[model samples]
Target chain A: MTLSPEQIIKLGDLAKLAVTEQEASTLAVQVDDVLKYIGRVNELETADSIGQWKDTVVNTNVWRADEVRAINEAERNELLASFPSREDDFAKTAPVFKR
Target chain B: MRANLTIEEVQNGLRAKEFSAVELTQWYQRQIKEKNPHLNAYLTLNEEALATASLVDKKISAGAKIGPLSGIPMAIKDVIVTQGIRTTAGSKILENYIPPYDATVVDKIKKQAGIILGKVNCDEFAMGSSNENSAFGPTRNSIAPDRVPGGSSGGSAVAVAADLCTYSLGTDTGGSVRQPAAFCGVVGLKPTYGRCSRYGLIAMASSFDQPGVLAKTVKDAAIVLESIAGPDRLDSSAKDKPLKKWAAEIDQDVRGMRVALPKQFLEEGLNTEVEKSVRLAAEKLTRAGAKVELVDWPLLEMALAIYYIIMPAEVSANLARFDGIRYGMTVGAEDLWSHYQQTRGQLLGPEVKRRILTGTYVLSAGYYDAYYKKADLAKKRMRQLFAQQWQKYQAVLSPTTPTTAFKIGEKTTDPMAMYLSDVYTVVANIIGAPGISVPGGTDSQKLPIGWQLMSAPWREDQMLRLAAVLEKE
Candidate 1:
């Protein structure tokens, strides 16, 4: 199944991207080819496939103890320095709502 | 110093005072200066490298024993953030972003006194198979200037192959490290997932991405892994596991070790020379007293599909941070929504955008169950299949890539074609198995072919030991 340019436009919107009509048409075909290939997963069968799904822990990584172990001064300062737009220490962003 | 020298040799040279660490660093710097313009392997050079080298030299002069990586110049993939070093991850979005702290691997390597050479180029966010997707420009194959360096670790592979550095670090989300190592004729080892901490690595598909080593020899790969692989407080995924003396363990006997050659890897689209090399490698192993057999692994074919679906799903989530709010360049648009769109659209490369969009669709409301959920189940099935294979065979061997290095721009426009390059390498990441790719031999085209080996989880010991046998010829 192919995704139309309109669907791609919708996806681009959700993804916070802006694709031109040309790119959308191209992506429509490319994305369809990928989706078609991946669709084979729907046809695959396994011995334990029936009703075996269960929610499990996401991964094996152990969580650190709950505490606020602050970063060192250099690290903190550099993180603040990387801010795209900021005043003093607070990061600045485009207004969420119109003025 | 002899060219393409291994880490051991560098250690010996320094101990014997044959060459000072400062001198060795200079040699690599000279090599980078001479070759980098043509290869585009390095995107930035560390100005403080000499200071690190001087510190190593001072330690030596004081008669203090140094670490294994002391005085060794190494390159890092740009995707791993380095404190005080410019790390762009090969995207224009992060063009001016300088990281505050080094990645866990970087910090560990620094603790071992490994001299930082510079950050190398990669496909943006480690997304593509070929280095062509790098916004900085493609890294040319060191062996053949006209050919592409298989990527997103293209610069790391090129750096090691050309002797620009003793070894380099790269990531293998899906063949980023191994493909480039194969193309450029080097050694790349992707340890079991969580073996190396992912703290400070620019996330693409968080589950699949692992920092790896690109080196001139199998043992050097082991050396790097030993230095950097361990649990970290910063990244919870890094489990507390015993770090092996990998370099020393690689010399163990391979006799009676059982190896399986997946026939699926030899099926159509595999270059004949690569197949010949793999079969010959098996024969050589047999002669070395290891058991080798051809086996049908139908499940291997389905991994690429699962990877594409799940990987893009993860990609969309990991990359949402680049919405022009916290870091990177910002576009002055009317509101936050437009700012995100304009900044990402104007900065991220086409491949990055494509994957993000595809990921958005797979995780969308209507399609989530059909694509993402199904792929998750398939991934579980693949894990079981691989676990069963490892029970009988100590390791599984395959060609690192389907073909040798292709010419520059050959697969640029074709995303699917580029994705196919990871077909053989993605299985390791999916199952969290440790993998290594050694120089199998040269194809008829004189291009290098990679002979890949995967061991059971945390079994890099047996894997590297067996790889050493193949590295003989």
Candidate 2:
């Protein structure tokens, strides 16, 4: 499972990473090792095991009542204070979406 | 055994008024001050530890009955969330990130009146086996300072072995807790998957990450495990199965219990000293009246490979939450997308970034079946080995690692070599069985080795029983 340098960079880009050409070159070798390492998973024979896919018997989730509540103003302030940009009672930042 | 006293002794001392919690906390704090400069074991030290201990002492004086773990001071792995404390997960991005709420295990331990000794170092997002990937710095092995501490729970094990604390909480994702304990000559447990809640734990490889404990003695490990185990609603994956009576069953004999040594794990790559120590432990068990057998688990060979695939794929998913949008470290940029890339690129360590990239490639649309699904199927096969063995043998045994701790930089440049450090320990996580690393003996270098004991799913009591018997011998 060899990957081209361009393919590796594409994956990194899609993953929201800023990889240098040098780092990409190193990753090509490391990723190849990872691919080769995980290939050993193909050696197992798990034809008869079904319980591995069914962990639902372990625990069941129950519903809880929803209630409007106040956020801890002090804690929220502390959180906002750590941000590099802030305004008013919220963290200030660029718009999340652009058209 | 001043450095290896059990939790029971510490509790008894506090109950008898022999020493106040404040005194005990100070003792541990001083020990950390003296030892940690060399080991790099701790990420933060709680300034309020003694004050908290004073409160516990006042409660004890007033005859207010406390939990079994009351007044015991311990460190927490940086990966677990600690409200109002910096929980970095050994990443530069989260170096100043203080979680707003305690993780479920933290809440439980705090309820038992345990004193917080602050957070210990670990691999970034629990990505690496050795502590070299920590953004803070690598944790040196307590036994041999020149060697690496098995990680990403290396700091917790070092703290326990060096007597910096009574016990520490560690998160084991693919043997982060157990392997380090093995290397540091302490006890570590990776409880049955879902035995401990994962809520508020900075997520990393969600399916395999288990919050476990490290302690100087097997009994102390059980005491901590008891406090944190049991189902919790906060973590949806937590199991509803009854918590094992670990402390209660510690004294039970392992006589007549069928134990098997998986030949597949014992042969070839294992170090000669580790093999000798494990076999000697097996002989001790046999002398204690248990039947020891050699068993074959060929599928165990695929565990490390499957783990690397499933773990990083999940790492990519779990760490995706840190994209500088809502919380933690954020680097400002002209656009939201740039904000994410710039923030993560600056904040994450090299190993973490490498894993995220590998995970994305593996989980990409076209490659998911060939990589992720096949790894899942391999995990299924590993589980079958457990099912077959548990029906005959009560537990499986092997050396925890191929050797004792290696030199700090021995394999740092080679990620594959570092990944193989967890080769023996990863199988249990993949199979979702309970596994423990019991300190067996040391190599000629005086570095400690460990013998791993694994049992069927939800059978921690039996595993602990076997471990206790080994401890006695």
- Writing each residue's lDDT as its tens digit, candidate 2 over B290-370 gives 999987667778888899999999988888888765567777787777777788877888898878988897889998877
Q: Flag regions of model 2 displaced more than 4 Å.
A: A44-68, A82-84, A95-99
Write candidate 1's Cα lDDT for B311-397 as tens digits.
999999999999777778777898888888889888988899889998998999999988898888888878877777888999998
lDDT of 1 by residue, A20-78 (tens): 88888998888887888888888777435555633322444455578877898877887
Best-performing candidate as measured by lDDT: 1
Best by TM-score: 1
TM-score of chain B of each: 0.99, 0.98
- The C-alpha stretches of model 1 lying farther than 4 A from their native spots are A46-48, A52-61, A70-76
Structure candidate 1, residue pairs in collision: none
Per-residue C-alpha lDDT of model 2 across residues A1-99, encoded as one tens digit per residue: 577777777887798877777877888888888788887765554444355553422434566677666778887677676665677767676677754
Model 1 alpha-carbon miss at residue B53, Å: 0.4
Looking at candidate 2 chain B, the ten consecutive residues that score lowest on lDDT are B377-386
